[model samples]
Target: MHTDLWNTCLHLYARPGVERACLNLQSQGLDVCLLLCAAWLEQRGVRCDDARLKQLSDCAEPWQREVVQPLRHLRTQWREASAHDEALGALRGQIKALELEAERTVLRRLESLTQSWPSDQSQGDCDWLQRMASLAGQPDCGALQTLRAAINRA
Candidate 1:
């Protein structure tokens, strides 16, 4: 729920190449939830590296690596790849698929985060859910609506 975590998740999930992002997050000892969140963040074009790590709400990286330097090598290749529309589209599709997975993961985690809250924080509950919804990219309002219905039932 930390902004850094939220922002990181938003970017990680949205990044163009999710498997690498996921692998990096995993190597950092982040839980699947956080991995899902990072994947979400990357999907949104927010890069997470040592420079940005300190800003994360969850700023604990168990396995530190100076590997961003090498990983960035993909940028040139990606630029060259732009010439091939079919390959680019396929890669984008893969990114979309990873984002969808992270979205579903976020949705599943919502209930637990909600239930574990103290009643005194009721005023902020909806706002938190909205943020989660936004991070999930639920523009069709489907996931938000489902979450609302689920909470109502409880």
Candidate 2:
């Protein structure tokens, strides 16, 4: 298993079906970075509790809203016009890169937040992904399961 959340996400995302599943979840208004963090915490055996969940949400939501979303909105807005405009396409690509970096920043922040939490101490009932999914909205169970299975495989 990857030792860091970023690498874990990289590995999981490269796995078959994981990217699609994540996109599906994202379409349901879930933050993929936050979900990825949930998978990491679950794998690390960190106990999932209300306080921890709130901490994760608190750390992720603001940056995602204020930083990542704007870049994404701009990038998506340019997708069609960028197809025909070379300079716009280049700028759009840069925005995409910024968006990715913003996500990485949030992932790193999440990792730092949980760095002191002990592993292998989670109670048997801890299900970070399910809990996070439920909080986000009614995300597809199959998508959540795909992420869960990928994490388990890793």
Candidate 3:
């Protein structure tokens, strides 16, 4: 599942424009979080859908409600609005706002989930070092060595 999520994140982050890449990553990451949450709810014999989304986010303030519930609505508008339409400007603004909020909410959900079962993360510090080490011919061994020293101290 983590590998699948990493791949999805990578693909989304590798898109053309910076704004588009950020938005895509935000959307894809939120989708993964939503799937995970829905799975957890389903296993407990709970039905998860738009109704559940509203109920879960009901106590949230107006901005939060706008972020969680109107995402689909904004996406639909963004997709349907013609490129030549002047109304596209407003839709784009709303989409960007919702994207930012969704990213924040998904990050919070990920933090909570990680706190709950952090041991389930099988990846280790070495994985990061190995990936970084493979990136260049003359890598910054100093940084890597410092990291290793810190780990040893821990």
Task: Write candidate 1's Cα lDDT for 61-95 as tens digits.
Answer: 22112222222334335555655787875775555
Per-candidate Cα RMSD to the true structure, in Å, reads 13.2, 1.0, 14.6
Assess candidate 3 and give its lDDT: 0.41
Per-candidate local distance difference test: 0.39, 0.92, 0.41
Candidate 3 displacement at residue 38 in angstroms: 11
Better of 2 and 3 by TM-score: 2
> Is candidate 1 or 3 superior in TM-score?
3
> Which residue pairs collide in model 3, if any?
none
Q: On a 0 to 1 TM-score scale, where does candidate 2 land against the true structure?
A: 0.96
Superior by lDDT: candidate 1 or candidate 2: 2
Reference-based TM-score, model 1:
0.27
The total of clashing pairs for model 3 equals: 0
Q: Write the per-residue lDDT of candidate 3 for residues 88-141, one digit (tens) a residue.
A: 867777777776567556545543433333232332322332232332233344
- Give the range where candidate 3 is weakest over 10 consecutive residues by summed lDDT: 117-126
* Alpha-carbon runs more than 4 Å astray in model 2: none
Candidate topping lDDT? 2
In model 3, the runs with Cα more than 4 Å from the true position are 1-30, 35-66, 120-154
Name every residue pair that clashes in candidate 2.
none
